[model samples]
Target: MPVIVLEASDFTSPLFLVRTLEILSSCITFSLVASLEDSELNNNPSNLHFDTFRIFCMFTWCFFFTLSLLMHILSVIQFHSLIPISWKNLTMTVAVLGALMCCAASVLFPWLIMDKTVSPRPVVAAVASCLTFLAYASESFVLCTQTHEQRGYMGSMPGLLKMFQMSGGCQMIPLVVEVIRELPSGVYMWQMWVTSVSYSVCVLMSLVTLVVIICDFAGRCLLPFDRFLAGFSLMGVLLYMVATVICFTKILQLRELGQQISHESTGLVIMETVVASITLLAYTVDLAFSIKLLCDRGHA
Candidate 1:
């Protein structure tokens, strides 16, 4: 009897699958951007700022998703060089591509919901959030499967599981905020108040995740810069959350008081304006911090 060994290169390649996923992801990003612009135009005739901001958000999201797609594809290519054409790796590649596509779609929902006739943006946002959740869930599943295969089931660690959950939460909270933002106008004041509360929740989750990552990285002595970046990121999130709550509360109070008294109180109006100003300031700070953190992480 003779013994034989089969190398990874001996297996037939899955070039078509790789190419197909790349094409699909690219097409979805393009479609979502175009649709967002079209939907924005259909919604408002005078609010150019709103339209421009939506376009900007769509572009930013597309850029990130494209980068993520590239990284995933490269990872897959590298993995193929090391291992045979296993179904697990192929499935993981497909899932990553799907997740990227869903994220692209999720980011475009804000513009889609901008159309006044289409009801509040929340309806589209809710669907987008659901899709985003599904994508993260799929990624978590892949990670768990990989862990199980590499180390027997009993070898799984709590920290790894927590990291997965935290990562998923970090990706999910913004989508949740968008969903709340799109809520219908007729909802009770208390229900509308939840929008501000949701912003706080998102900020809290982001901060917690940043802290966990910071602690994890510190324990390994891998990166000190990450801690600095995470700290600033947490500050930005907190400021944004506070500003949102104040601004929304002011706006709601003004609206309710006007409805009940059929008159505008000048002091309340001034306070409302001030809150809006503070909100803008907070947003600027948050944006600056985010850009700095991203640049520091070599992601920008």
Candidate 2:
């Protein structure tokens, strides 16, 4: 019998490993900040200063949503040759386009609803935003599930893929919170139901993504191919799930707080801190991953 051992040094690319670890750390930090901030907002709806925060969050959400749509379109156009003309690809293409439209509509609905000055316009925007989030999530899932051979050039850069995922997750937060804020007080039943359903769905999706990533890392049969891209894709899904859960929890808490607490004021401070923390953590992870990639390249 012969003794055998496996070590981190046995890995081909130390740089890649380092980068991956950095990315993982950064993601965890982002989730922590986001979760904490959301919890704070739920606990205290007053004492948060600055009306600008709301506007900033709204603008940021819309900007990312628009950018995501544009990016997806560009990806499709750039990889047009790789796109199969078969029924399945065509169907996916159509679905992707449709999802983009839904996302656009959701992002813009708030503004449009504001102009109506009528019954339930706010609620409408909220519902639209939720739909848009679902569409985005679906689009990502489709992309992740595509066979590696079909992925084409899109599989090249893990960073770019992860960026899109983070962007989607980041955008989801404010829109959801905004909708909840707009709803009337004593609106417990509907909010509770919607929040529970949304959180559960998000959790399930995250778990699926985690499983995919784990399999990829284990070098299991690559169905969708491109492990690098898959890793990033899964990261996005996980991040989105975490953010959604945090947001939903905050909403649930706020609901319980009732009229005694000034939600807007408290929410602003809490959200600002949370968003700021999440943003910083995300950027840090981004930096760490970039460094790791660079190191790998240097070794190569």
Candidate 2 RMSD computed on C-alpha atoms after optimal superposition onto the true structure: 19.1
- The CA-based lDDT of model 1 is what? 0.43
Candidate 2 structure, TM-score to reference: 0.34
Question: Over 4 Å off in model 1, which ranges?
Answer: 1-23, 31-40, 79-137, 145-248, 256-300
Minimal lDDT window, size 10, model 1: 153-162
- Clashes in each model (backbone N, CA, C under 3 Å)? 1, 3
Error of 1 at 99 (Å): 6.1
* lDDT, candidates in the order shown: 0.43, 0.42
Please state the error at residue 200 of candidate 1 in Å: 13
RMSD after CA superposition, every candidate: 13.1, 19.1
Model 1, TM vs. native: 0.39
lDDT of 1 by residue, 1-300 (tens): 332434465333343334334445444544544554345336554432344334444553455346546645545455434433333333343344345434534544444454443433345443544444354445535445555554221123422322232233333333333323333344334633553454455446444543544333334444564454345445545644554565466457657655443232323234333533443354345446546656777854
Best by lDDT: 1
